[model samples]
Target: MKLGVVGLGSMGYGIAASLLRAGHEVCGADVNCEAVERLRTEGAMSEEIVTAAPDLHALVIVVLNSAQTESVLFSENGLAPKLTPGAVVICCVTVPPDFARAMAARCGAFGVHFLDAPISGGSVKAAQGKLSIMASGTAQAFEAARPMLDATAETVFKLGDSAGTGSAMKAVNQMLAGTHIAAMAEAITFGMTQGISPDTFLQVIPDCAGTSWMLENRAPHVVAGDYTPHSAVDIWPKDLGIVLDAARASKFSAPLTATALQQFIAASGMGLGREDDAAVTKVYARNAGLTLPGEE
Candidate 1:
């Protein structure tokens, strides 16, 4: 298969490398010239993505949000017009289901298969090609995307026979994920107020019922005082915004998710927007006037 991956951030870069290793001819592009050159050295084709359109069997868009995803496919230099009729587009952004449905319809006009495929398991898993993919699309879209999915995913969940469902499920997952991160911050900080160290919280929490993938993955960054952004505080605002918007449309009450969204917002407002999301703990620490470890 010939594949083109746009947006070579941590996740996109890994997905492109995985495709390249799976014997697919991969063309990778990004605004980051350094990343493109690096991947080029790793056997990725150096052509600008637009130039590789007609040759690509699958075009994976792992950008940040719905607008960027739409821009990549429909912008002035967009690939849709240049794509071969049966080519598939696997959209892996966190977006609303209605947006996914709309994109699918538009892609249908050009005979391009659009799969609403949002991914999980973060950058490390992405590098190992073991991410979990929540995917939904028309049968033709699935058939066209299967090879690429097989190359990148450890678990490819077929959510439905249309594009929106995958986005719907992704919204659900983000609600829980965003909430978990905020909850972890709250719990860890609360433990500190009672004289428990972040290290102690981490050691005991994983075996408790409160443990979650997000907590185990993120809490260590707090304990080590490594605020480097594997996933930034800004990401949750976008992801959880998608969740709340979806919930609003469906009249679903997501009070817990709503509260969690506020903490990330506060963290970003405090100029911590680009920090690792575990930095949400700062919101809790500031409130209680408790200094977290590694902080002055």
Candidate 2:
């Protein structure tokens, strides 16, 4: 398959690598020249996406949000018009369902297939070609994207035969994931106030009924004092904001989601937006005047 990945961030780079390993002809593009060069060294094509657009069988978008995704596909010099008529645009960004539907419609007008395919399982899983994709699209779009999907995803949930369902499902996922990470931060820091060290909390939580995938995955970062972002703090404010917006549109009550969004916003306000999301623990730490593991 001839594929192009438009964002070379952690998750995007991983997806590009997985496609290359699957023996696809993969070209990568990013605003970060270094990320493009890094993937080039790993057997991705060095050609810019514009140059490669005509021959691309599928273009996978792993950009940050709806706006970037829109710009990538439909901006003045967007790739959608440059693509071959039958080429598939596989959108892996978390976005509002309406945005996904609109993008799908626009792509259809260009005779391009649009797959509203939002992904999960993070960078490690993406690099291993083990990502879980929540995908919704026409059968033709799915067929057009199958080779790329086979290379990049371990599980593809065919959510519906339209564009919005996949993004809607991704919203549900982000609501829970962001909330869980916040809950994990709160619990770990709350334990610190009780003299239960972060280390001790990590040691016991996974074996307890209250533990979650977020706790097991993120608590270790807090314990090690490593804020290096596999997923950054800034992601939550946007993703959870999408969740809350969708919830409000449906008149849904989401008190916990609202609370979690505020904590992440506070974490961002404290200049922790670029840090590992586990660093939300720092917000609690500051509120309680408790020093975390690596703080002086």
Candidate 3:
């Protein structure tokens, strides 16, 4: 299949690389020219994407949010006008269900299949093709995107054959994912006040049920004191913001998710927004006057 992947941020870059490695004819675009050039060096041809857009079997959009996704698919230089009839559009942005439904309907009018496919397992898993994909769409969408899914995911849960369910499930996952990350930050720093070092906590916590998928994955970055972002601190504010927005739309009271959003907000206020999401712990660390690993 000829594949065009848009957005080469941490997650999107990994997805595009995984597709290339899977032997697809892939073209990549990113606002970061360096990322696009890197993909060019990896055997994806820039000339091919534009000239071949009409024959492209699938277009995988792994952008940060819905706006970017829409821009790539339907904006001025949008690929929707160029994509072949019956081609599939795979969306990997974290977005509201209504937005997902709207995108699906718009694509349907173009004789294109749209998949509401938001991803999980972060960048590491994305690079390794071990990420989990929560996906939903028409039967045609899934069929068209199957090869890409098989190449890029360890597990693909078909949540429903409609636009909204995948985004809904992604919202549920983000609610838990954001909450777990915040809880991990809190517990690790609280342990520090009691004399348990971040290193020691990393050594002990994974074996306990108090641990979570996020803790097991992100805690090591805290212990290593490497805040170089695999997932940036600012992503949570957007993702949890999506969760809270959807919650508001549904009149749902999500107290835990709300609290987690505040902690991430505090982390951003501390100027850690550009750092790794694990740096949320630093908010707690600073509040208690505690030193973390690699601190002065």
Candidate 4:
């Protein structure tokens, strides 16, 4: 398949690499010139994405939010208008259900297939071509996107036969994921106040009932003091904001999600926005006057 990938950030770059590995003709673009150059070295098409857009059979958008996704598809120099009819767009941004539906509808007008496909499992899984994709769209959209999905996803859950359903499912996953990361920070730091080391917390927690996927995945980052961003601290605010907005529209009270969102906001405020999200533990560490791993 001839594919175009926009964004080329951690997740986007990995998805593009996976497509390249699957022997697809891939053209990649990003604001980061280095990322685009790196993909070019990995055999991605050297032509500009705009130049490649019309000939693309599929375009995988892995941008940060709905705004960027909209700009890529509908704004000036948007690629949607340039795509051939029956081309598929697999949108992997974490966005609201309504936005997904709207993008799908607009793509329908252009005879393009839009897949409301939000992904999970972070950078490592993305690099490994093992991410979980929560996806929904028309049957034709699914058919159009299946090859790209197979190249990039280890698990693809077909949530429903419509655009909104996949985003709704992703929202639910984000709510829980955000809360668990925050809870892990709280518990690990509380243990430190009682003289439990971050290393000890990691050793014991994974075998305990309190262990969660987020806890297991992120706690090790804190233990090693490596704040290298597999997933950055700032992502929670946008993702959780989507969850809370949806919850609000449904008149749902999500006290836990609200609280977790605040902690991530505080982490960002503390100049850890670009750090790994496990650094949320820094908030608790500061409050208790405890030094964490990698702290002086």
> Using Cα atoms with residue i matched to residue i, what is each candidate's TM-score against the true structure?
0.98, 0.99, 0.97, 0.99
lDDT of candidates 1 onward, in order: 0.92, 0.94, 0.90, 0.95
CA RMSD per model (angstroms): 0.9, 0.7, 1.2, 0.6
Write the number of the candidate with greater TM-score, choosing between 1 and 3.
1
- RMSD to the native, candidate 4? 0.6
**Model 1 lDDT vs. the true structure?**
0.92
What is the C-alpha lDDT profile of model 1 across 29-140, one tens digit per residue? Answer: 7889999999999998868788889999999998888899889999998898899999999999889999999999998899899999999988888998999999999889
- State the weakest 10-residue window (summed lDDT) of model 2: 287-296
Best by lDDT: 4
Q: Per-residue lDDT for 133-195 in model 3, tens only? A: 999999999999998998899999999989989999999999998999999999999998898
Name the weakest run of 10 consecutive residues (lDDT summed) in model 1.
44-53
Q: Write one digit per residue (lDDT tens) for candidate 4, span 1-296.
A: 89999999999999999999999999998999999999999999999999899999999999999999999999999999999999999999999999999999999999999999999989889999999999999999999998899999999999999999999999999999999999999999999888898899999989999999999999999999999998899999999999999999999999999999999999999999999999999998998888988886
For model 1, the superposed segments whose C-alpha errors exceed 4 Å read none
- Residue 270's lDDT in candidate 3: 89
Model 4: lDDT to the true structure: 0.95
TM-score of 4: 0.99
Better of 3 and 4 by lDDT: 4
Model 3's TM-score against the true structure:
0.97
